[model samples]
Target: MYLFRLAMASLANRRFTALLTVFAIALSVCLLLAVERVRTEARASFASTISGTDLIVGARSGSINLLLYSVFRIGNATNNIRWDSFEHFAHSPRVKWAIPMSLGDSHRGYRVMGTSAAYFEHYHYGRGQALQLAQGRAFASDPFEVVLGAEVADALKYRLGEQIVLAHGVATVSLVKHDDKPFTVVGILQRTGTPVDRTLHISLGGMQALHIDWKAGMPAQGAGRISAEQTRSMDLTPQAITAFMLGLNSKIATFTVQREINEFRGEPLLAILPGVALQELWSLMGTAEKALFVVSLFVVITGLIGMLTAILTSLNERRREMAILRSVGARPWHIASLLVLEAFALAFSGVLLGTLLLYAGIAGAQGYVQANYGLYLPLALPSRYEWTLLGAILAAALLMGCVPAWRAYRQSLADGLSIRL
Candidate 1:
């Protein structure tokens, strides 16, 4: 305890250099921990993007491509499945529930998804959590009503009862729009930290009504144009959809259902287990994730090296101090122990400050990140693995401290009662 106080007092004497070292280490530690937390949470979010669904059925394509378009909304689908085919499997005894998805539209930059009320009740994410409305109610039988995702509403500053127009295509700056049939935002979903947060949802009837007046991929002109009110009286059932998700009555029947959907006579359909597909997609991204972690680790090592350099550099100037202590009944080992304690104190303080900085950053940016990137960064306590990482950092610091400690001890012994300078 005496040695610790002595070490701290010595550090206090060189507070400027000590503070810089601590700040450097704190920044590095904060960066490393931030990267790790994002990596873990991103993986969790990716895996939980779509849960409680047994099979995702879509037009035959690469599993990754299908998963990308269906769940992540990354790309366009090669083909659309007939709505009758969706009905065929939806009514099957093995299927518990099904949610049809009709994509390929966009509001501003956010993708527009056409689905049923069953979507709110059946679709789930993040540990089987159902979609909850943060404001207003879900779209009803009205073909002009739309539901906005958390990110979509927040980013676009939309409110319930406000009318918004959707583009005919999924482009950020779409030239063709369904301006004639403006939809009213009836609901806003809570943030889900998934692709869903970036989507604008509408009923299938609304989706069909938007295109009801179109002829051969082009909007009707003048006399042929159909207004939104006029389309309400027409049958607006969707003819096709990009994909659909299914929940099975029994987990054991998953493979059987997948096989049946893959071999369905109505169309060239593909069915995949959401969990397996998510894992496969995440595996492709593992290399990049590891690379980021390695980069953060190297940054921490650089910070530690800077600390080591600072300590070693100060040793020459403090040689006279060491010699005086040696002459005043301080053993060489006490000098070494003092250096060790100094290093430990610096590292411990850095770790603590870094943790605090991390939490502060999360608290400040949590809502913005979730609103913009659909990633929720929680300000929760560090995990066991994080504790292990901090421990490893301290251990590395201790190991590095030994080098300067040994050097100081040797110098103190050689310059007993004499100043080198």
Candidate 2:
């Protein structure tokens, strides 16, 4: 009890240094926890973005690339799969439903996805949840009609029956605009916290109509422009699509369908399990994740080192105080234990402060994170792995405490009594 009081008095006397040390440790702990949380949640969000689909089929390309463009609205596809090829697999006995997707167009800045009404019926995200309309309904058979994602509607302040023009290419701003064939917003989707929320949905026919006046990817100077009324009577069938997503009738058939698509003679095609492709994509980012983890660990070690420095630096000024204690019957081991206790107290306090800061920050930014990044960070207790990390931190603090404790133990009676300052 006496040693504890003396240690508390010593820390209070140098409260400024003690406070700074605690703050350093707290910030380090916050960063370590934040990095791990974001890493875990980001990967989970990536995986859950498009679920319930057995495989994603695209032109022969890297699995990660296909997953990126098809699901995440990332880079352009190297080549498009034929519409007929999509039909062939979509009708197979082994397949349940295949959702065709055509890309390479944009409205304002959001991506315009050419798909079918079947998309609303068949496409699922975040565990078999079907797409639902928050207002209005899905697009009809008309090629001039379009549906808006929840974010598209909210961000652009669009309403049902509003007319919007699409750009020729996928750029945020395009020189060539399809102004003649404006689409009526027929539907607004409910928020899914996925890529679906960021996409503008249109029929495959609409996609073909947008490019019908073009030949070899450039608009013909004198090409005939078709009116919206004329587009209905014209052949609106699509020639090729960027990709397609398939849901299989049986999980056992996944490998068989994958093999069939890889060896497809109709066109150079590729198919991959969505889960496997997601893993492949994440593997590309594994280095960044590891780097963050290593940096966080270093920050923690640095914080502990700061605490050790503060305690060791204070020991010299306290040599006379220590000699007085020795004269009053205090042992060197008691002095050593006092330093250890002070170190543990600082560490424990820092840990608590850091944990509270982490949770508070997470709670405050949860909505913004989901709105911008489509990542849902759960406000749950520390995970088992986190507990292990905390335990390791505690153990490291104790080990560091031994440093100043040993220094104090080595001090002699004469050394403390002869201190000048």
Candidate 3:
């Protein structure tokens, strides 16, 4: 207890240096914890985005691209599966449910997806929770009715019963608009923290209605434009669909169904397991993740280096004090313990401050992230991995203090009964 008091007094003598050391470690700890949290949550968000769907089927292409466009909404699809393919699969005995999608349109920079009602029925996220309507009701069998994702509604400030115009061919600035026919927002989905939240959804008939007056990417000038009622009179059969989400009738037959979809002779198609494809995507992103982790480690090393320099540089002024303590019957071990104890206190204080900062960050900015990017940044309890990382940091802090402790031990032994200036 006396040695501990002596350590406290020694730290108090140089409070400015102690404070600087604490601040340095605190900043490093903040960066380290923040980066790890992002890594864990980002991967969780990615994996949970398309859960409960057994497989994603699309036109022949790499599994990565298909998953990217269909699930992540990161890129465009290479090609589209024929509408007949969707029909066949929907009726296939091996399939339980299938939802078709049509893309290549956007509303103010957000992707516009044309899909059937099966999307809301079969699509699930975050541990198989079905999509729920936050407000209003689903489309009541109307051709011009639409549903908005939580992000789209929030960003565009749209409400139920508001009218919206669809743009042509995914161009935000396109002059071509479906001005003749508008969609009424029938429903708004709750936040899912997935790509679903970033999309504007409508029925395939709505997509067909918009393109009725245009052909081969050109407007039919003489045709003028038709109203939504006229669109109902015309056949709304879709030739191609961007992709389809599939659910299997039997979980055990997933491989068989995937093989059948891949080998379907009607047209070249691809089937990908959502889990397997997500792992593949993570594998592709592992390099970036590793780089982030390495950068955090360097930041920690830099902080430790700053602390080591401050302690060693101040040793000259501390030598006289060390000699005085030795003259008062203080053993070398007591002097060494004082140094170690001071280092531990600095490190402990820094870790505490860093953890508080992290909590404050999550509390403040989590809502913005969830609303805008479909990522839920929850303030979770410390995970086992986090505890382990903290333990490692504590150990590193102790080891770092050993340098100054050793120096103090040597100084006390050499200056017995003599004051060193």
- For lDDT, the strongest prediction is 1
Candidate 1: list runs displaced more than 4 Å: 412-421
Order of quality (TM-score): 1, 3, 2
Q: What value of lDDT does candidate 2 attain over all alpha carbons?
A: 0.88
**Cα error, candidate 1, residue 144 (Å):** 0.7
- Go through the candidates in order and give each one's C-alpha lDDT: 0.91, 0.88, 0.84
Is 1 or 2 the stronger prediction by lDDT? Answer: 1
TM-score of each: 0.93, 0.89, 0.91
Model 3 Cα lDDT, one tens digit per residue, 220-317:
67557676787878888788899999898899989998999999999999999989999998998989998998898788778877777787787776
User: How many Å off is the CA of 25 in candidate 2?
Assistant: 1.6
In order of lDDT, best first, we have 1, 2, 3
lDDT of 3: 0.84
TM-score of 1: 0.93
lDDT for residue 117 in candidate 1, whole number 0-100: 89
| Runs off by more than 4 Å, candidate 2 | 1-8, 159-162, 219-223, 327-333, 359-372
Residue-level lDDT for 247 in candidate 1: 93
Instruction: Name the candidate that leads on TM-score.
Output: 1
